[model samples]
Target: MKISDNCYVEIHFTLNNEDNEVVDSSLGGEPLPYIHGMKNIIPGLEQALEGRVAGDKFSVTIKPELGYGERDEDKVSIIDAESFAGFDQIEEGLLCQIEGEDGSPQLVTITHIDEEEGEVTIDANHPFAGQILNFSVEVMQVRSATEAELRDGLTG
Candidate 1:
């Protein structure tokens, strides 16, 4: 059956960045399963998989807006190093979670650290933001989702 909303779909896919580096892949592993049209995957990929059936193979290129979205300068900020009091070590490239405006944990990566100034620059943007993404995907299976699966928005 063709993939559609509420359907259980399985696919094997390799995700690459503009640098032609493999960011993620399901090759040599079990096919990833998700509920079609449930936002289980990126918008570009899910849209591309629409109407596809098992055995379908295709490559799609997604722009930043459709993937992780363009990077926002406002999302990068420098804060006092004392904010991370509990952490023993504070270094560049360290990833940590902070409370966001909505009271949810937001992941931020340490881009720069000034030991002398006691300041840290953290970027909240997604790592892939502002980059093009390429996906090579093969539909492995498509089937009607069970009632429980539909309710949970997952595949079993």
Candidate 2:
């Protein structure tokens, strides 16, 4: 079977950045499985795998827009340190959740600290945001997805 809308696909992949640094991989782990065409993976990768069959191997390079999107300067903010008082530590590189403008929870990474100013710099962009992705993928299986699985936004 070929990977297409409503199909189930199993793939093993190694994702790398422009510098060839390994960003993620299925090494020593089960191949990733997802319902094809359901936005289970990056848009560029999902679209590239369309119509591909099991045992197919290929490499695809995706731009930032189709990957995590270009990094937005506006997503970085400097906030008062007291907002994180509940945390035992306020070290940089810590991941924290803050209330977003809509009152929804937003995940942000601490970037800097200003002891004198009592401020902390945080960035809400995904870690991989603005980076191009180079993927080496091998399709393990491709088959029709069950009706129930499709309804649940998954593949079986």
Candidate 3:
């Protein structure tokens, strides 16, 4: 079977940043499985996988807009460290979610901690934002989506 709408696709892929650094990979592990056309993966990768058959290998570059989107400087903010009193450790690289302007939870990463300054730097942009993603993917399997999978809009 080929990858298409409602199909279950299993792929092994290596994702690299614009700098050619391996951001992620599934080469030595289980293949990632997702239902095609379900928005379960990035738009660029999903579009590239369309009509692909099992055992096909290809490389594709996804622009920032299609991958994680252009980074917004406004997403980065410096807030009072005292606001995080309940947390045990407030260290760099820690991920947390804060309420957004729309009253929704927004995930933010702790980019820096200013000890003496009593401030913390948080960024809401995805880590990969603003960078081109280079993906080398090998299709491992493709099967018709099951009835339950379709109803649930996902793959088993």
Error of 3 at 107 (Å): 1.5
Candidate 2's residue-wise lDDT over 30-107, tens digit each?
A: 999999878988899999999999999999999998998999999999999998988888888988899998999999
Task: Write the residue-wise lDDT of candidate 3 on 12-98 in tens digits.
Answer: 999998789998999999999899988899899999999999999999999998898999999999999987898988789998987
Model 3 has an lDDT value of 0.92
Which parts of model 2 have CA positions greater than 4 angstroms off? Answer: none
Predicted candidate 1 versus true structure: per-residue lDDT over 1-156, tens digit per residue: 999898999999999988899999999999999999788888998999999999999999999888989999999999999889988887898888987779999999999999899999999999889999999999999999999998866634
Root-mean-square deviation (CA) per prediction? 2.0, 2.0, 1.9
Which 10-residue window of candidate 3 scores lowest in summed lDDT? 147-156
Candidate 3 wrongly placed segments (more than 4 Å)? 101-103
Clashes of each: 0, 0, 0
lDDT of every predicted structure (CA atoms)? 0.92, 0.92, 0.92
**Least lDDT summed over 10 consecutive residues: which range in candidate 2?**
147-156
